[model samples]
Target: MTDLERFKNILNEHREELEKEYSISNMGLFGSYVRDDQEKGSDLDILVEFSQPISLLRFVSLKRRLSQLLDVEVDLVMKKALKPRVGERILAEVVYI
Candidate 1:
């Protein structure tokens, strides 16, 4: 399978654990990986939705956990924090897992 497929599978497999630990209600993959245009250093772009407010520390922990799980750098973003225009484009192509 492709790296992207592996990443999606890994995340789906750990979805329950991550949701319980991070209060994440939903997650989606976007950016270069989604477009199949990623370079060697491209980080996985994940748009995450939390079920409740979480501290910055917890957010960072989530990012780190995902990076470890996928064995790739993770650029996590809060779905609620997205700007209108950018969000539209991202949401357009995002693949939720």
Candidate 2:
């Protein structure tokens, strides 16, 4: 199967685990995978929306869970809102909700 397909399966398999651990409102795959060019060395960019701000400890735990499941370099970020801001620039590789 293609990487995107594999990603979807992974998402499906871990949906419940993610919700239980992070109290996530929504999760989506972006970057290369969304563009359909994910490869062995390609990283996964996941955008996560949470109902409320998560503590550092909680976020770490959630990251650990995701890392274990995917066994790849997982880049997880959180945003207060799902909507992208006009002229909003994100400098860092990781953003937390």
Candidate 3:
């Protein structure tokens, strides 16, 4: 399989674990992997929103879970919801799951 195909397959294999570990209610694949061809060793870019706040410890824990499942480097950029939008961490970048 191609890189993108393998990447997607890896994601499919870990969906349940992702949701359970991260408490991610809204998870999606957006950006290069979804639109453009992924080069070898390219990152799996995803966007995820948890129902509750995600602490640093939780982030690290989730990353470990993904790593075991994929056996490939996984980068998780978790975004916690903050109200008013005055000062919120930009969620523009993609996060791999």
Candidate with best lDDT: 1
Could you tell me which residue pairs clash in candidate 2? 78-97
RMSD, each candidate, Å?
0.5, 5.4, 4.9
Off by over 4 Å in 2: 81-97
Name the TM-score of candidate 3.
0.59
Tell me how many residue pairs clash in candidate 1.
Answer: 0
- Identify the runs in model 1 with alpha carbons over 4 angstroms from their true place: none
| Candidate 2 lowest-lDDT run of ten | 86-95
* Local error of candidate 2 at residue 44 (angstroms): 0.5
Query: Over all chains combined, what TM-score does candidate 2 have?
Result: 0.71
Count of backbone clashes for each model? 0, 1, 1
lDDT per residue, candidate 2, 9-86, as tens digits?
A: 887887886787778887766666666667778877777778777888998787777767777667776655434651
The weakest ten consecutive residues by lDDT in model 1 span: 1-10
Q: List the pairs of residues colliding in candidate 3.
A: 46-95
Model 3, 1-97: lDDT tens per residue? 7555676687777777777777787665544565566566766555567877778898788777666765655656544432435213234433344
Q: Which candidate number has the best TM-score?
A: 1
Model 2: how far residue 13 lies from native, Å: 1.9
